[model samples]
Target chain A: MELYDLELSGNCYKVRLLAALAGIDLTLKPVDFLAGDHKRSPVIDLNPWGELPVLVDGGTVLRDSQAILVYLASAYAGHAWWPDAPAAQGDVMQWLSVASNEIHYGPNSARLVDKFGYDLDKATTLQISERILGLIDQHLQSNEWLAMGRPTIAECAVYPYIAVAGEGGIDLTPYQNINQWMARIKALPGYISMPGVA
Target chain B: MELYDLELSGNCYKVRLLAALAGIDLTLKPVDFLAGDHKRSPVIDLNPWGELPVLVDGGTVLRDSQAILVYLASAYAGHAWWPDAPAAQGDVMQWLSVASNEIHYGPNSARLVDKFGYDLDKATTLQISERILGLIDQHLQSNEWLAMGRPTIAECAVYPYIAVAGEGGIDLTPYQNINQWMARIKALPGYISMPGVA
Candidate 1:
């Protein structure tokens, strides 16, 4: 399997994190995101959205990190990371939506602005970050993991952006439960680190 | 099964559309969105996010329309709506993320601003809408359905917003393929309509 990735992107790191945890071997095809390489050939050819973390496994090509997680976990990993049950898939999916929507707009966008100098509303990103972080913190207060009562791809989908929220100039100090959850994820065997994620 | 719904919400309509198409029975528990009922006890108790289209199925409670569609299709609707294979699930999931992220921030947010008078960046919403709409149109140009080579929950997840894009002040006239795709979805068995869609 070939993964067209960006070293600093939380989205890309999330996929890599899942692969490492699930023991799935992948050849990392690092894209030169800083040089507008993602918008050009090979990458753009695979994904018209011109996004990083495009996975090409045999004949299957997928974009979007959440979708890639679904593919990788289901195909290569096993049911533990991506379950077969409908309700369980739905349970894991809620956080996948969170990762795709809230985390993307909140901490991810904030990092894009602060780290990559992308033109985005910093205040709005911070506001969104605070709201979503609060919700996740509260959710974590009662649950040991994000979903399925055990480690699943939900952790893989959500943990990267949060681990690197400091790069976005967003503070994670107040989110105690979230902090503990991050520690739990870090302590997991086969967990790997990327540029921004510790 | 119960759905905490709002008649005018595309998110809610997506779930209803899936139920109708899949023959899944749901007791409509319409929330008075205008009166801020969604933020109150019952709705908020089920989904702390205070979002519309919350589903409660006995032991299972799911929020996010995309997640609900996953549950309904996988549990009751069968493999035709939501497939069993990994690559197929990933294929369907690509658009699910679109429904959750791009569609939510794009046309959905635009509608929120224009129709519901929410204080959101209309310009940004339109920009996001244009980009995503163009991408979907382009994808539809080559493919018949969004995924799995036939109608699936992707249509339910995507159609409602595009059907009512006019309410968001988004002109869909340029996207001929999207219009055609919408027509096909409407022609599906057990198709239902919401306000501003027709």
Candidate 2:
């Protein structure tokens, strides 16, 4: 199995982090966004969207970070991280959807823009991030993880961008419960810090 | 179970569509955004974000339409609509995430702006809807359903919005495959249309 990875991507980080936690060995094949590798024809042939952290196993290819997380959890483990329970599964999916839509759109994009200079509305993005973070913080007030009382795919997808969001000029000190949850996720066994872009 | 619903909301429509298809009995509790219901203290006390279609089953309340889909499928049908196969699960999630993030953000929001008279950048919203419809056409080319090889949660969550997107002034003439897929899903047993807003 091969993972087409980007060191700075939170979604890609999701695949790498889960792989580390679940003990799945995959050759990390770096796709150079600096060289516009994902935008090139060859990579576009694999995924038309030209997105990063694509996973290729045997003859199959998968794109999108949340999709890759599901693939990793389902293919590698015995449904522990993904969970098979319906109500629990719903809770898990809710968190993943929030990560994909709100957090990624707001905080993740804001962080990227602050560091990398992507064109996005700054004030609105910050406001969006604040609302989402507040929701997460409220959820974490009693729950140990993001969803279903277990550290499921939701945490895997949402944690990275959120943990590093302060670097985007957004303050995290206000979100006490979320801060504690971030610490808890970081302290988990087999935890790997996201690769920093120098 | 009580569903905090808004008839005009595609997100709310998804929960209703799934509950009908799966035979899950739910009471639809209306929340009027125009009436400033969500901004008031009571609904926010349940969901601080004040989003619609919150599924309250016993003491557990689940938000997010995609989350609700997975929850209904899990609680009622186990892993049937969500699927359990790793590679298949990846397919299911990819479409599910797209429904929540892309379809909802693109076409759904565009429709809202045009039909609901919400202030927005009309040109950008139209462009986004076109891009999403194009992507949906591409996906429907080889697959019969939106996610996986079967009628998974992806189709259930997105079909309503995509089908009625024309109401929001998005021309559907270009998306032949999508039109065909929508027809096929409706032809399925237990399929139910959302209640008319009039």
Candidate 3:
């Protein structure tokens, strides 16, 4: 299997982190995102979205990091990461939606502005980050993990950008539960880190 | 199953459309959005995000519309809607992410701003709409359905907001392929329409 990756992107790290945690073999094909290599032939042809963390396995090619996590966990990592039961799958899926919608527009967008110099609404990103991060912190107050009472791909989908939220100039010190959850995630076996994630 | 719904919400309609197509029984507990019922008890207690389309099935309570569709499809509607294979699941999931990220921020946000008086960046929504809508139109130009060459929950997840883009002041006349795809979806068995969907 091959993964079109970026060393600095939290989206790309989601895939790499999952592959590591699940012991899946992947030949990483790092895209030169700085030079706009993602918009060029191979990456653009593989994924029209021109996004990082595109996974190709045999004939299957997936674009979104959430979808890639679903594929890798279900195909190779067994039921531990992606469950077969409908309700359990739904439980895990709510967080994946959060990963795509809230996390992407919030902490990820904030980081895009601060670390990557993207011209986005920094104030709006901070507002969104506060709302979502607070919600996640509150949820963590009652639950051990994001879903299924165990660490699933929900962790893989949501943890990367959060682990590096400070790079976006958002403070995580007030979120005690989230801090504990991050510690738990870092302690997981085969856990890996990217440039931004500590 | 009881769905805490708001009739005018595309998110709520996604769940209703899936139920109609899959023959799942759901007792609609309508949330009075204009009266801020979604922010009050029952709805807020069910989903802390205070979002519409919260599906409560026995002990399983799912907040997001995509998660609800996955639950209803995989549990009651069978593999035709939400597949069993890992690769097929990934194929369907990519569209779900689009529905959550692009569709929600694009057409949905535009509708929220125009029809419901939300204070948002309309220009950004339109730009996002143009990009994602064009991509979807191009994809549909060659393929019949969104994924697996069949009408799955991807249709249920994505078709609602696009069907009602006009309410958001979006001009869909230029996208011939999207127009054709909308017609095909409307022609499906047990297809139901919400307000402004036609």
Task: Give the worst 10-residue stretch by lDDT in candidate 1 chain A.
Answer: A189-198
**How far in Å is the alpha carbon of B105 misplaced in model 2?**
1.6
Q: In model 2, which runs have C-alpha deviations exceeding 4 angstroms?
A: A195-198, B40-42, B78-80, B195-198
Give the CAPRI rating of model 2: medium
Clashing pairs in 2: A86-B74, A86-B75
Cα error of candidate 1 at position B143, Å: 0.9
Instruction: State in Å the error of residue B2, model 2.
Output: 2.3
Q: What CAPRI-style quality would you assign to candidate 3?
A: high
Candidates in order have lDDT scores of: 0.93, 0.80, 0.93
In candidate 1, what are the lDDT values of residues A57-121, reduced to their tens digit?
Answer: 99999999999999999998779899989999899999999998999999999998999898988
Residue-level lDDT of model 2, residues B1-198, one tens digit each, is: 888888878888887887777777889889988998977766677676788878888977787888888878777765667676788878878878888777776777787788888775666667767887887899789978876677877788778788778767788888889888888888888887764321
Better of 1 and 2 by TM-score: 1
Error of 2 at A197 (Å): 9.4
Model 2 RMSD in Å is: 2.4
Report the TM-score for the A-chain of model 3: 0.98
Arranged by DockQ, best first = 3, 1, 2
TM-score for chain B considered on its own, for each of the candidates: 0.98, 0.92, 0.98
Instruction: Kindly list the per-residue Cα lDDT of model 1 for residues B106-169, writing each as its tens digit.
Output: 9999999999899988999999999999999999999989998899999999889999999999
- The residue pairs that clash in candidate 1, if any, are none
Question: In model 3 chain B, where is the ten-residue run with the lowest total lDDT?
Answer: B180-189
